[model samples]
Target: MVIPVLAIVFTLYFFSTILNSPWTAQVSAFSLGSLLLLFCVIFVAKTVYQLRRGDGTLSFGNIVSRDDLASGRVGLFLATLGFTLLIDYLGFTLTTFLFLLVSMTILARGRGFMRITLVSALMALGGWAVFILAFDTRFPRGWFETTMKAVLANG
Candidate 1:
């Protein structure tokens, strides 16, 4: 319920901002926003009908709770924030590897660290190779990437 409301508001603001852009530049945003708004309207109507029928009630405690934040979710959120902020400095592959390793360690409760690290490293390297090498997608080159290139060149 709260998610849909936020999505509707976000879509409206996004549309407003993109309105001045050229058609080609705004087409994807316009299309996606239109669909989002349409679904939101339908959801709103259904939710209102359910409330009038006493079938559903909004509970702020359930929707946005301090307990959720207290239960290590805040740490996960902070971890994600850190990942996003440090990505340009760490580069995609290394950042993703560290993020996955940390998140798994946090959530896995007594899981073996070395096993998790190995798995994370394999997945991260595979993803980086696929996207950066095979597909030729461009990701930010930070200190790690630069050093790897230098080592490879020197070898």
Candidate 2:
């Protein structure tokens, strides 16, 4: 319920921020945000209905338990935080690769190191190819992107 409320608030705020942008820029944001807001509203309504019917209680007891801690949730959260913080400096591809590697390691309980590394590398490269190379998005450029651009331009 709390998550849905927060999502609703944030989606509205996101919509507000994009109002002054061009329609092209606003199109994707508006579409995605509207869907998020709709789902959040539905969730909130369902939770409220359940509460009114005496099927639920407004308790935070189950929100964060020992099981959640043991399940690597904290580690995954930290990895995400690190991705955001380092993206500007490390650039999209490298930061995404590192984030995925760390997150997969945490979720896999440190097993399958080779497979995780390969998948992370492949995913990072795929993202670079699609979003950076093909779409030419405004993501920050690091050594790999810079080198790739130079190689492509020369070749």
Task: Please give, for residues 15-101, the per-residue lDDT of candidate 1 as tens digits.
Answer: 888788999879999888899999999999999999999999978887558976656576677779989998988998899898888
Backbone steric clashes in candidate 1, count:
0
Off by over 4 Å in 1: 7-53, 60-77, 133-136
What is the clash count for each candidate, in the order shown? Answer: 0, 0
- State the local distance difference test value for candidate 2: 0.91
**Tens digit per residue, CA lDDT, model 2, 42-121:** 88889889999999899766877677668998889889899989998888999999999999999999999999999999
Global Cα lDDT for candidate 1: 0.83
**Relative to the true structure, how large is the alpha-carbon lDDT of every model?**
0.83, 0.91
Model 2 segments more than 4 A misplaced: 1-60
What lDDT is reached at residue 106 by model 2? 96
Candidate 2: give the clashing pairs.
Answer: none
